[model samples]
Structure formats: structure tokens, C-alpha cells
Target: MTQYQPIAAAAAATEWWRGAVIYQIYPRSFADSNGDGIGDLPGITARLDHVASLGVDAIWLSPFFTSPMKDFGYDIADYCDVDPIFGTLTDFDRLLDRAHALGLKVIIDQVYSHTSDRHAWFQESRSSRGNAKADWYVWADPKPDGSPPSNWQSVFHGPSWTWDGRRGQYYLHNFLPSQPDLNIHNPDVQEAILDTARFWLDRGVDGFRLDAINFSMHDPSLRDNPPVAPGAGPRRRPFDYQHHYYNQSHPDIPTFLARIRRLLDSHGGRFTVAEVGGEQADREMKLFTEGFDRLNSAYGFNFLYADALSPELVRHTIDLWPGAPGEGWPSWAFSNHDAPRHVSRWAAPAERKACAALSMLLLMALRGNVFLYQGEELGLPQADVPFELLQDPEAIANWPNTHGRDGARTPIPWAADAPHAGFSPARPWLPVDPEHVPLAVDRQEEDPDSTLNLTRRLVALRRREEALRCGIIRPLDLAAPLLAFERGDGPDRLLCLFNLGRAPADWRLPEGWTVIEAVGGEATGGSVPPLAGLIARRSA
Candidate 1:
């Protein structure tokens, strides 16, 4: 067992989550301990050493609660118990204990927006109209013509409302039909969800990553959403046809968030980061984390779903949050379980290494907390899951039009020579990408200059420099292909520059600044190489 070195009490007391690097682990694809072809809590516990070595402050795990595997754990059946496939509650406790021993905070995903149809609450709600849990889920009466209650659409594809013959009405679902939306407007529902959070806190969880928080509350009147303009990008499903105004992003969400914040405040030093995405993501993200009374931070799809990485995009996104008074902190993620790996999305095959290194430097320099996905440190690209093995409901629904999320949720490559990349002794849930074999953790550990090691160095650099960790961001005026910014905190000032193009670029060095760290390419003769990133500090 490795000795634990706890962070200083003084630094953690104020705010440890600000500018923290959180590594996200998609539990189903991370590792399989029992060789049942599924990743479990014990698997994650066994892999804690690798995660702790990355210099990340915490680990944000995806849902592992009891579920029917319809949404791969997202459709949670039990809010308080661990799934049998992921191991028992004891296994979770052991995992949490091990993580805390290694100085890593544990942040679990909280899906308060909906629950599985098989959940006890939902089963009872859908059983009879006047049962104990009758109004636990969003239910509405059908129109006289017998169509859905409104024009709302599920994220999976078709109508959001499903007919429930037993209740003689329609039940709303923002996602799959099996995952019914919770009636958070009900005070009893709010109390039950808050109790779930309290349960986890009592069990020693450090924080929560609230999933699809904006979808928690919906328009009570069930008003129709207006259609979007004709040329609003490609529309694979009916969900993209509308502006999504009334279906979600209701004003009552913040009131519920305040209740959650109050509960977390009682726990002390705990954090909460809400995941808000959609057309109104920017506004809702700010609303959810605006003051000290709500969530600590919020992240949207600013970079996750972007087609390209450009200077204008970076500037525009960073400009949204200025860290002014009363404004909450921001969190950023380029790649996660839901989105395609950024290396494949942004860079060509030939320049992936350089692009990965540059992206890491850029993420570390950004003025917010950063999230790195499971295999991101290895520079892993999106896997090519075949049609036969497709498991994601959304991908299977809309075939070739939408490249589904299964490609991004493939198993992580742990060993270069082992079968299934050492993820499981048996057949894994998702196939391992052949290209990822060469970039496995075992192979990268042997090479000191590998992407995995580079990530560690970058994370350490951010931790060592106060300016990079919690400094104010000031965008520098630069031409195309070059994105430059300065992070300053009193006397500590650092200038960060990145050449996001395939050609070399040059910038006149400031009089007092000197290069402190250079990755991917050298910064010499007042020029930066292709896909290079440079960090320089001003001399006192």
C-alpha cells in the first residue's frame, strides 16, 4: 500500500475544487474485476493507483446504482443501493475508502431528473391513479384525439409522452420510454432526492456531478415548443427540430438546486457541479451556479460537441464567464463518456500526438476546473464499434446518420498484449479499438515522453503554479492559428500560447517573458512549431 499525503488543511478549507482536475471514469468500460464481461466497483478500486498517479484531485464516476441496463446505468432503479453487476454496497464503501486513502476525492453521478420504469416508485406511480406514489412521475392526460399530450420529443427520437393504459393517461420521458421523468415539482419528490444525497454524504462521498440537471423540471402547462429554423445543421431525430424551450430548462430548477446546496453546506467542503446541456445551456448554466446559494460549478457543451478547435471559439466560450462578483465557477471538459474523443474529432491521424499534447496544455491553462476522460491521458481516439455490437439506444435508433456514443464508451486499453486489453478476463462489454493497443497504459509507462506522462507533467505544472490554478484569464490579441492568453495572480503571471494549426506560427515574445514549458514542438527563433504549445513566465 502506498502512503497517503493529504492536501494541506488550509488550502482545502477555502475551496479545493476551484481549478481542480477531475478524472471521469465510465465504470462500465473502465475495468471488470469478476471477469463477468462488465466493469465493477472492485475493478475501479484496483485501478485507483493509476488514477491517483495522474495528479488529479478527484475522480467523478458515472452511475453505478441498481438498474435494468436499459440506459447502461443511467436509468437507475434504486437510488440508494449499488447494482449487483457493479458489486455490493460494501464494495462501494471499500472503493471509496481506498480512494480517500490515496488522497483522491470521490464524486459520484446523481441522476435526479428521472428513474427507471422498474423502480419501485415508478412501478407504484404507474400502477394506479390514486396510489401512494401516484404523482411521483410526470403524468398528463391525453388529448381528445388520443395523441401525445404536447409536441415535446424524447432525446432518443419520437414523442416524449408514452401511453399508460393502467393510469388512463400519458407519462413523460425526456429520454427513453423506460426512463420516466421525475415530477420534481412535488415537494415529496424533492425531499426523497435530497435524502439520497444525504445518504451518500453520510457514506463519505466528497461531492456530486449532477447529471442532466436542466432536465429535472419541465413546463407544468405542457406548452408546445416552437420549431427551429430550416437550416439549423443536420437533424437526425425529431428532438433537434424544435427550440426545446418549454419542454425543459424550467425556472424552478434553481430553487431545487438551492435546497441541494444547503444540504451540501451542512456536510462541509463538499462540491456540486451540474451538467447542463441544450440550446439554453449557457443561460441555464449561469442560472444554476450564479451565487453561493446554488451549485458550486456547472459545465456545458462548449468544447465537447465542437466540430473544430478555433481561436474564435475559445475566446467566445471563455468570454461567457469572467469570474466577476456573484458569478459561480466554471468547469470544462473536451471529452467524456457522452461525447466523441477530442483527438479524433479535432486532429488528423498524422498529427494526433502533437494535437493531444497541445490540447492538454490548453485545457490546463483554461480558467476553470478541468475534466479528463478515462483514456484521454493515453491520447485514445474514438473506437469503431461495428453495427452488430451496437448497444447504445440512441445510436441503434438512428443508424448511419448519427455517430452514436458507443464509440466513445468503448473499453479502455490497459495492456498491449493481453486479450481485451486486460480490461476483463472474459469477453468485455464493448470491443477494444485495435488502434488503441499500441497506446496502452503498459506501453506508455515504459516511454517517458508518452502522452500519459506528458499529462502528468502538465497536471503537476498547474498544481505548482498558483497563477495557472486560480488566476484570472485575459485573452491576448493574436492572429489566426494562434491562441494566446495570460493568467495572472498578483506577482505571478504566466503567458500561454498554442498553435492550433498544421503550419508553424510566430509571435513576438514580450520583453520580460521567457519560456517555462514547451510541449509537442520547440519555441525557438521567436516561432512555434506546428501544433505546439508554450508557457512562459515574466521575470520579476
Candidate 2:
């Protein structure tokens, strides 16, 4: 009975994302046109053909909005316009048209949590207390001792409050001081964001990835957050010491998300996925996307922050989202803009090939919308970006403390021998990883067994199999070193087995199972070789 549920829901018109594949493009690193050091909208437009070739259903672009680049484009100055460095709005139009032409839906990032202080709205809000726009941002009076209103810490490394002489009050910023949080409690602010969405929807964007949406609202009382015990998991910064209760995860966030959903629904078939991170992410993600009135899905940082991949970790993470009723759909990504590449993080130098193939296979087999970051198909490892070339603010600030994002964000290598690895004719804003040159798309395209080709085959495999898409994952109790699960829905059912360890694992296939696809090393109905991943289908 339960197996028939998703199969029924999967047939609905709005369920395109139920098992869709999304390719994420960090615009500035994807490609460069006009010989500029920076990649622009035209560059991404030229690369749509490649993304479409991977058989992904849609594309999720990291922020390319008007910004001062404080936190890259996550700190938006103009929600409705493309940043000059990323090319004009017309360039984006062409990109959207090309993406649709290739049958790929375009999903842009929307940062409603905060706006660049340089934004017209924030500038006016900070001008004077009695001004019309002053209350548009989060403004609170200082304590009698002129101290900050609360003990809330900014994610960047300091007090969340910044004193403003112009307003004679402290404005709250959950991130960088230059990026002030919007007062989402204000109806006008909500309308402004909705209008921004309307502008894009009317212009033809198919969807949006709401950035830090869980932080869209804050507790109005400005209560001090209680500290976590000392020595909380790798506490390198003050921001990691508290529960972050009063600063984010406000109860009212779902209301605003519903408004966003309503607007997206007005445009028809438009999707909205929230980027929900931090403590209480699971609960908040459910609330933000709980029903038909909210977002379609939310992706957290489970695998993104994991140190290693194992049977226990994979099982635990999969169980986190069980597709329970009233629970929103979940999305998963092994690598993305902010995350270090899994090929480097999870595999040893010699085992890199096996790791890439097995990981890609595992990622695609999971039951959710999967995101494949640019170059992930090519198994690009994290670049070793030296300190001199660091561009990411978080990376630079916590240099020795954190893994830093610059390594994973280095420009993609399109051609092994081309200048700047064919990312740009001029020097790129961030250095292209020398190691990535050998794994360039051009070189991998020549070899049928390359990770690039394997990725395409796996993508196609997932697309054609009903059991692989929109099915429920039933974890199988296997011994250590082997991970197995059965994915089933309606008339389609398949068994997936993975040998996670370096040694061969015994696995005589069940009586009725027949091999469908095998990679890394196949299971020959007797033993599964090291790093092997196999899919066996059940005969109807």
C-alpha cells in the first residue's frame, strides 16, 4: 500500500522535482566570455549545452545578482538586476532562453535573508530612525550600557549587532556587517521580495533557490542565546559556541515561505527550494516546506559537512528524511559551491577513480532530487589554492581553522591544453587548479570509461528506471563494509548493493534478482569486488 503512494503522487503535474536532477553552476567559475577574467551570463549561456548533455532536468545557478561581492553574490544589493560583473540583464535573458531551448529549467538563487548595505533599501533604512524606511531593517535599541541588544553572534565572527550613528540604534546582521538582515516581520519588506520574485517569474525564470531562508526572520525579543558547552565539535570561532536560537530559526519563517510559494504558484510549475542550514535544520526545513502552501523542497548540510562516507553515515543520513506524511520532500548534493569536492575529501589519491564512480552512483541512486555541481561529472578534485589567491571571505577569515571554500570553487577546466584551461582567455578571478587541467572535460570526453562518461550513463540509468526515481528507500541490514538497500514503488523494484571497503565482500544475489547495472567492480552473484556498486532489478 505504501509503495503505491509515491507512484500515485509521482504522476501529478507538480511533481517534476520529486526525482529530478539539478545541475548547479557557480556562474563565475563555469565559463568566461569576452576574455574577461570573470565569467558572465553569456559564459553560462554558452555552457548550457554541456549541462543539458548530462541529462539533468534543471540548473541551479549560484547568486549572480547585483552585489558588492562582500560574501560573493549572497549579499545582494539589487534583487531584481544582474550584477555588472556578471553581464547585463539582457545577457541573463539570453541564457534563460538558451536553457529552455535545451529543455533545462533555470533556477536562480534568491537571497532574502539580507541585502548588501549598499542597496537602496538598506541605505535609506540606515539613514535616520524617524525616516520612512528606517524600520525596514532589523533595528533595536542598545542596552543602557550601550552594549549590543543580545549575545547573538554573526556567522562571520563577531557580534550580530552593529551600532549605527545615523539611526542611533544597532541593526542586526546575521552574516557580514555589510549585509544587514531584513525585517521580514514588516509587510512592506515581504512585498518588496515578492515583487522581486514576480519580476523574475514574469521574465521567464522557472524557479528559485532561496538562500539562508531559515534566517529570513528572527526572534523579536532579542534574547541572548545560551552557550553550548565548551569544546563543542571543533569550536574554532565564537559563532559555533551558541545554539543560535534567538538569531535565527524564528517561528514566523514559515509564514513568509508560504507567501513565496503563493507567488511561485501564480507563475505555474515554478519551483522553490530553500537552503536551510545550521542547528534545528531538520525541524525548520519541515516547517518551511511542510505542505502545498510552502516550498517544494529544502536541502541541508548533512553530506556537505560530513568528514567521510560510510555505511553507517549513509544509512543515518537517508533515514533523516523518511518521506513521512506532512514532511516536505528532501534534496541531496554530495558537492556544491560551498562544499569541498567529494572526490578529494572521501578518496585517497590512488582510489580517486573508484571513489568518484561509486559516489556518483550512490548519489544518483538515492531517493530525492539530486544536484550535480559543475565539474562533478568529471570527478574534479578540490584544488589546492594557496593563501595568495584566496577570494572567499569565509576562507580568508578562518584560513587555518577551516578547509576554506576557495579550493572547491576554482574555475572549471574545459580543455586540458587551452589557455587558463579554457575557462577564460584572461587570468581568472580565482586561479584554476593546475591538477584539474588533466581532468578537463575535453580529455574525459575521449575515454568512454572516464568518470565523465560514467556520470552520464548513471544519469541516464536513473532517468529510465522508475524504481530509481520517486521510490522509497528500504535500508537492508548488511554486515560491515557493505551497504545495501532496496528501492521500490508500484510495479518497479530494484536492489542496490555497494562494497564500501577496499576488500571484496560476499554477496550472492537473492534468488530473483538480476543485474541491471554495475560499476566500480561488479557483483557476479558470488562476490562483490572492492569499491563495487551494483543495481539488481526484481522481475515482475
Candidate 3:
């Protein structure tokens, strides 16, 4: 018997996220409505048709809730309400209705670890020691010398603890000082989070992508982190000088994940994916989604942070997720708002187009669910954001040493000739790059051979073939630069191969195999051209 059944049936069985193609939308850069220089829910609603045309199953919207925009919506001020800048709650409802009508599931970002300084919860928690929500956030007394409680450093800058005069104590902030860490160990806080989840679930949300989930809980003892060994790598900031043991990845995370899963399960059909980033991300990811009682999936920074994409890198990343019973399904994305684009990281000046095509094809062919970032389909390279225009805090602070994430977050050009490339009537928060104008969606829509079309073809193949959708992957033994794998080896089988080197790699399409999709130069039976990929199938 073959695992070649129609994927549509499996999709209808409430496990649509298992092998679904999720497109990530960085709301601020995706589209702008109201001529306010920022993308809003209405803007996203208008673009849903374009997204649906790409054949993706869902969209993972980045944070867009009520916030101060200090960390660009990650520092959520209100988890249950829509931010005014983005739009009103009514606007979000409209967007959801439109997306569901298009047969596209919608998932939103949930930042559980922290809340913005402007959030009512944080404000109350900081008001006084005896307030009802005084202990809702993590707070610790300072050391004898009035320094931070521990050596834990924040991801953005200096110490993780900030002095709060109101409480006469120091509060934990794993990111910006304005974003206070939630005390998930507190039972009241857990219930509060669950209530928040229910609020959205009641509104008919399909899922949530938990942000920095591992940071939701911390060691109650307030212990210092272990110092890093000498010369591990270049210490970018104080945060890089420690092993990050006590401050994050607490054992209680899985228990909370079980609570989250149970809550979503109560909703009958929903999805949950965690974003776990750190040195122990792999271990934490497995633990968080280890069984049926936890999250449905989790994605690490494997491909997102890799300096180069290669056969060995893909092989190593795939091997981590077995896709077997009892093992959690893995979700993958090469680029997101937080990281630089893959083409920028993997290819130089002239090779971005080929690199983008190859990576897109490869992402869709993988065994588990995959996410495609906005603008990736257009083969848009990372825009050059100089110091004067840099918006990302980390990038601004680490200028020259690090290019940061702003380059990859430039506004997506809709029309090649329009002012601001049709992004908005007014200037966008992020400038539209001149180089990206030629790669606009409208321009690609006019060319059948464009990377955008390649994405559509590849995505259509994923939807049409069970082998590429939900089938198990088996790596084929091949020399360097030639990565090959088999999907659904029984019937309706597939052999997906990629040539990652500068030169073409030889490969013969097995007898009786039919080409499904090919991209990047000629993907003929004789060879897979450099920076190319081929998906071929065999039918009984």
C-alpha cells in the first residue's frame, strides 16, 4: 500500500498544519492602507488574494497587536486587542473573514514571555508591591551593591534586570527594558494567559505561533548564568558572554505547553507552533513538542541563521526531525522578519535569483510544514539599509559589525513603476529599494519564468503530490554539492534533488519517472544545473 492518498482528505482531517505551506507576513512591510505609512489589517485583507494564488495553506502573521512598537509589535501591550496603528478590532475581523473565505487558515503571533511597558498588566504589576497583579511579572531584589540580581543579559542590550522604583525591586526583561518578563511559574499568570487564548479562540482564530516561548519561565532562584568559555566566538554584546542556562529554557515550559495544547484541543481544530531560539533550542523544541499533549510543531533557527545553504546543512537539519510516531513534526523557514533573507546570506550579487529559486523549491519539498516569507517569492534580495535609515534596535546598536534584520524587512514592492513601488500613497516606514522595483509582484506576474511563478509551480506540486506533502523523507547517498532524497517510496514516489554548488551536478532521472517541477537553469535528466532543484515522480 502506498502513502499516496489525496492530501485534501488529510487536510480535512484536522491535521492540515502537518504538511501545510505557511506564508509569513511581516504586517508592517507587507502592505499599507489609509496612507499612514504603515501596513494595516485592511492592507493585509486586500492582499489575501495574491497570497491565496500562491497555493499556500495558511499565513503566519507577525505580531500586530496593541503595542508601543518598540520591538515592532513583539512587545505586546494588549494581547486581546488590535493596535490602532494597524487598525481596529473590526478590521481584523474583516481580514479573518476574507482569509477564511479564501480557504486560507490564519495564525497569529503570541508573545508569552513578556509584555510591553504600556500594557495594563505590566503597569499594574509595577505600580506597587501590594497590587493585585504585583507578582504577575518577574521581579527580584537587587544585590548588596544595588546591581542587577544576576548576570543574565538581555538579547538587545545590557542587564536583563531593570530597577523599578515603584516596587523597590528589579524586574526581569529578557529583551528591551520596556518589555517585562511574565511570571509563568505563577498559577494566576498561567490562567491569565489561558483566558487570553480563549479570547482569540472564541473569535475563531485558527492557530498561534508562540514567540520566545522558552523565555516564558525562568529559574525561581534567580541564579546567575554560567560564563561562556574563552574565545567561543565574537561576543557581539553582553548577552553573548554567558551560556544562558538559568534565565531561560526552564523545565516547566513543557507543562505549560501541555496546558496550551489542551486549550487548543478544546477548540477542536487549531494549530500551535513555538519559536525556540537559543543554544539549547533543538533540545527545547523536542521537549516542547515531544508528544501529543504538547504543541503540534516547533521551528528552530537552523536554516534562518545559517551563513550558507548547502547539502550538508539541509541534511543535518532534516535528520533532526524524524517525522515518526511519538516524534513532533518540525516547521521550517529560511527567512523571517527577525533574520536576514536566505538569498542575501547564501548568494552574492548576481546569484540571488538562482539561489532564491533553489531554496524555494527545496523548502516546499521538505517533509514537514514549511513557511515562506513575504517578498521571498519575488526573489527580492536584502535591501541595503544604511545607518541613517536603520530601524532595528540591535542593528542600530551594532552598526557596521552587523547588518541586522532591517535589510530583509524592506517594504515589498507591488508595482515596478509606482511611487514607493505601490507600497503606499505615502512614504512607507521602511523605504522601498530601487533594485527591488524590477522584482515587484506585478513585474513577476507578467513573466511566466519568474521566481514567483516557480514558487507557484512548486507549491502546486506540493498540493498535488502526497509524496511531497506528508510523505517521509529518506536522504539519498550522493557526493558533495548533490543532495538527493526520496519521498513516499511506495507508490506515487518522488526523487527530489538539489545542486548547491557553483557547477552543475550530474543526476539521471530514474527510468519511468516523470518531471513534476524543475527550476534554476535546465533540470534535465543529465544534470541539475548549479543552484537548481528538480522534483520527479514515479507512478505505478
Q: Each candidate: what lDDT?
A: 0.91, 0.87, 0.88
What are the per-residue Cα lDDT tens digits for candidate 2 across 1-540?
A: 122235355343356777899999998899999888888899999888888889999999899999999888998889988999999999999999999999999999998989999999999988887778877899999999999999999887679999999878999999889999999999999999999999999999989999998888889988899999876677877798899898888888888888899999888888989998898887777787786799998986778877788999888777877777666778889888888898888888889889999999999899878999888999988888888889888777877888578888889999999999999999999998888899999999999999999999999999898678788788888997899988875457888999989988988888877888888766775899998898988775
| Tens digit of per-residue lDDT, candidate 3, span 431-538 | 888899999999999899998988998899899887777877888889989999888757767888889999878877778877777877667768777888788877
TM-score of 2: 0.97
lDDT preference between candidates 2 and 3, better one: 3
The whole-model C-alpha lDDT of candidate 3 against the native structure comes to: 0.88
Look at candidate 3 and tell me the lDDT of residue 15: 84
TM-score of each: 0.97, 0.97, 0.96
Question: CA RMSD for every model?
Answer: 4.6, 1.7, 2.6
TM-score of 1: 0.97
